[model samples]
Target: MSLTIAVTGMNARADNPGPGLAVARCLKESALAPRVIGFGYEALDPALYHRGFVDRGYLLPYPSHGEDALLARLTELHEREHFDVLIPCLDAEMQSFARLAPTLTGMGIRTFIPNSHQLALRSKDRLPELAAATGISSPRTQAVYQANFFHTCEAQGWRYPLMVKGLFYDAKLAYNADEAVAIFHRIAGEWGVPILAQSWILGEEINLAGVGDGLGGLAGAVMMKKRALTDKGKGWAGISIHDDELLFAAKRFCEVTKWRGGLELEMLRDEQGNLHLIEINPRFPAWIYLSAGVGCNLPDLLVRLALGEQLLPTPPTPAGVLFIRYAEEAIVSLADFENITVLGETLRFGALA
Candidate 1:
């Protein structure tokens, strides 16, 4: 029998799309051909209407609604879909999902995600401590509870052009106190306090996506260098690369954290050739389909691991593989829109070719 898998973060906005749709694409194209259920918070999330990518679509309560509302919704969906595995692709929802893992397991829904402690350790506010513990070099970062810190930060020896960041998402380069304060309020208003302020490092950014085997070993790893970026600084075009230092950093990270499930490591390589761990995203990045392009297929591996199957050693990822992401429109029938908006669910009969 084909496994039923549920995935979240279906929003596909051109600026900063979520990782779920790409993950769904990976799973659909995998040999298992598992049934894909796309879960989103809004009715207009484009991936829900994508014909071949999502076999079924459902709306979920916003993460702000708290875990009880989330669990109730998942339970209802489970009664209808009997999902064998779940992949949550958003950072904001990781806490709730990780906290509910045992309850989800009791309900027969398996998730391969880091536990609460692991998730907390790698969070934005805790990156400094985690880096220090693992012997990784990360820029000096601190949590700012008030926007006023931006204006007075220079007095404390923090120079201009700092990196202002939200806890779950959004990052901006603040060139001066005004820019820093503006960005701080904007991100804080949306994602809430305390916003993060980090020393800006001039460097080339590289990223790695992989699954940890929950035992100090990375199951599979794929690295990429962004060729082009969207206005929001998201990767718009990227090329896969094999860098030993980057790979070693990832291995050391896995060894130290014993992270499970999907993870994205953001790194900045300075002009001096030192790699600084910038951020640790608890879930897959939006460029995750590149994993399939390089033969790792991390989402598929995640599912297999969730199902308690042993993963074969991943082959070496070849350098030079490229992925260029583009925006496209999908025709959504009024009937489907009505189902999602009114009844909160819709099913698609289309099958992948």
Candidate 2:
């Protein structure tokens, strides 16, 4: 019970905290009983982290305040209660965690992340270019920071039906130059930065999740196609997709990044049968828990890696296993309806104990 296991960036209301909870639960179930420390704007379900995996819980206003500040408290806590590992599931925390890894090592915390330059390449409008150079295909795109470059993209044959994507948030689709300029101003006013423009290809959305060894080796891989996505368009609500093409692109992307941690690859297929890289999430996405149920156990495997163990090749994680978002509907005021849509499965794991 002396070892501490921290799963940061969790909220009590979070429907799927995925890696944070999955790894915490695995460590606890395995009798590690490491203290689980969670940080976020809101409190987490104490029953999950504090009462179970966590022995002590503290809340922070936000992670931006300080990274090591929490660690300092952990150091204080370690004087009274020791910790063995720190697992970060938040996007904001990954780069900072990686930057501080050396210091954390000296302070007795085990963690992982890509270097800053690489991390920057993974973020914002620069991602697609990096992907293309590494033999991965990205959408027909242009990132415009200067006002004059908008016309440059048009001159290069990027025309109507293009997307003006917010660097930190949403993407506004404009079918013409006028609309594109208006959307650009709106986005620039709010975000105060350049926006990424790309041809809007309406096709199936796919995500490839996996882990890599810092070197060119892979630990595990799982593929998911969107069955449903939230209307506003950040992630999928339900997904239905799987293919070797997906896996190869994911493997190649991870290999190219030299990424060492959980990664979620966002991609799209055009009408010509080309796979285009969209985005790369270096942490667990919301649906990652579904992978565990299907037999991947990425979170558990990731924890073992943090403990400095050499990773084994990932076993077949249900190649055909599928996911559906369970939703409640009201047929009428008198009765409610629940829907469960089963998709497919390569192999299924036993229910969590």
Candidate 3:
């Protein structure tokens, strides 16, 4: 029998898309060809209406609603969907999902995600410590609880053009104290504090996406460098690459944390050619489809891992594989919209393929 899989992070805004739709596309194209259920917080999340990608769609309560609300909703959905596996692709929702992993397993929903402690170890505030533990270099970073810190940060040896970041998402380059304060308030208002400030390094950004086997080994890895970026600094186009240092850093990360499930490593390669670990995202990124394109197919591996199947060592991804993201309209019937807006679920009548 084909497995039913549920995935979250379905928002696909052009400026900052979520990873759910890309993950769904990967799963649909995989050999298992499982049924894909797309979960989003808003009715208008474009992925919800994409008939080609999501076999079914539903709306979920915002992560801010707390875990009890999440658990209750998942229980209700489980009775109807009978999801065999779940992949949560948003950073904000990861904590709730991680804490609820055992409960989800009890309900016959398998999730391959880091536990609460593992998640905490790679948090933005703790990146410096994690970098040091892995013998990798990271930018000098500090947590900011108030905006006033930006005004006097120069005294603490922080310079201009520093990076201002939220705990879970959003990063802005603050060129001066005023800009830093404004960014601090903006991110704090949206994602809440403590906001992060890091010494800026002039360099090109490189990223790695991989799955850890939960036993200090990496199951698969793919790396990329942004060729173009959205106004929000999200990668709009990228090319896959193979870098030994970057791969070594990822291996060290998995060895130290024994992280399970999907992870993205953001790194800055400085003019001196040294790699600085920037941020560790707890879930797959919006560009995860590139993994499938490069022949690794990490989401598929994650499903196999969740199902307790052994994974073979992934083949090396060929360099220069490119992914260019584009936005297109999904024509949706009013009935489908009403089903999600009014009843919170829409089941497409079709084969799994």
Candidate 4:
């Protein structure tokens, strides 16, 4: 019998999923061809998401907007569905999965994740610290809590044009020491805690995605650039170009971390052209399909690894492969804007092929 797997993710709502959609699609096309279930609040259309692949998709209730309701639901689902592999995605889910690994294993489901301590380093505040430890050039970074910490940042001579960020996600950038401190204090006051601080890099933004063996080895990988960013400043509205330097750097970074599962490294090529480390997203990235276009099918590799299969060794990939996201609108007056006809079609072919 084929390995039956279940991919866990939130459904799309006002917050359209960037890479999550791609991740689900990849799983749908895999050798096992596992069922994809997006567990979320009543915001996502499971039917639409499952249109092509899932044997049957489901929607589960959460305890409010938070995922505190997960452990029980996941436990119940595992018992009922009898899925061989369970992949919980998103930072929130990653956190829960790390905590629930032992429990899930006891319940007969295999999970992929890092320990909680390692996961913290993937958090926004600690990402740069991990980079520095790995000998990767990260933006100059610090964590500050109150006004005092902000004042110290300025007095200590932190570089100007800095990024002040949340522990879970990105925040705003502040120019000059004073402005940065003020923003920090304002944000901190609102939250009652410190946010992350980092020197901004003025250069090309590149992101690499891959999967790991969890035993200190690579499984699958791909590298791509941020050709064009969406309005939310999330990921590629369009992308083209791939680089080996990026692939190498990404692989080496994961090796250094001893990362055991899916990973995405967001790095910047600074003015001097150094690939300075940004953050490590140990989850599927927004444009992972772009990576598949070049031969690194992360989701497939993830499934096989989860199934305990041997992997084919991958050599350093070449540069110059290109992909661009196209959007379709009306040439003349029309009520319908068919994006599927433009960007989605080519991306789907490139991703599946």
Model 3, 183-229: lDDT tens digits are: 99999999999999999999999999999989999999999999999
Off by over 4 Å in 4: 11-18, 45-50, 53-55, 59-68, 147-152, 176-193, 238-242, 315-353
Instruction: Kindly report which residue stretches of model 2 are placed more than 4 angstroms away from their true locations once superposed.
Output: 1-3, 11-35, 43-57, 61-81, 146-156, 176-192, 234-241, 325-353
Worst 10 residues of 2 by lDDT: 337-346
Instruction: Give a tens-digit lDDT track for model 2, residues 1-353.
Output: 35567676544233333345544554565534455654444432322233444444444335567876755655664454355677677665677677777877787877755667667767757766777667877776667876555656667887678888776556777877777878888888877667788778877777877776677656777787766555556444544355788788766766777778778888888777788787777777657666666677666666677788876687666545666544322121111101111111000111121
Question: In order, what lDDT does every prediction score?
Answer: 0.93, 0.62, 0.93, 0.63
Which window of 10 residues has the lowest lDDT sum in candidate 1? 344-353
Clash count in backbone of candidate 1: 0
**Candidate 1 on 198-298: residue-level lDDT in tens?**
99999999999999889999999999999999999999999999999999988898999999989999999999999999999999999999999998899
Model 3 residue 58 lDDT score: 87
| Number of clashes found in candidate 4 | 1
Question: Model 2 scores what on Cα lDDT?
Answer: 0.62
Which runs in model 3 stand beyond 4 Å of their true positions? Answer: 350-353
lDDT of 4 by residue, 1-353 (tens): 56566665534322335355566767776565666554433323322234454443444544343545677677676676787777665665677678777888788787776767667766777766777676777877667766556556657777667888765554677776677767776776655466778888899888777786776666767776666655657653545456666767766766776777888878888788788887787688756666566665678787677667787886555566665554322121111112222221111211122
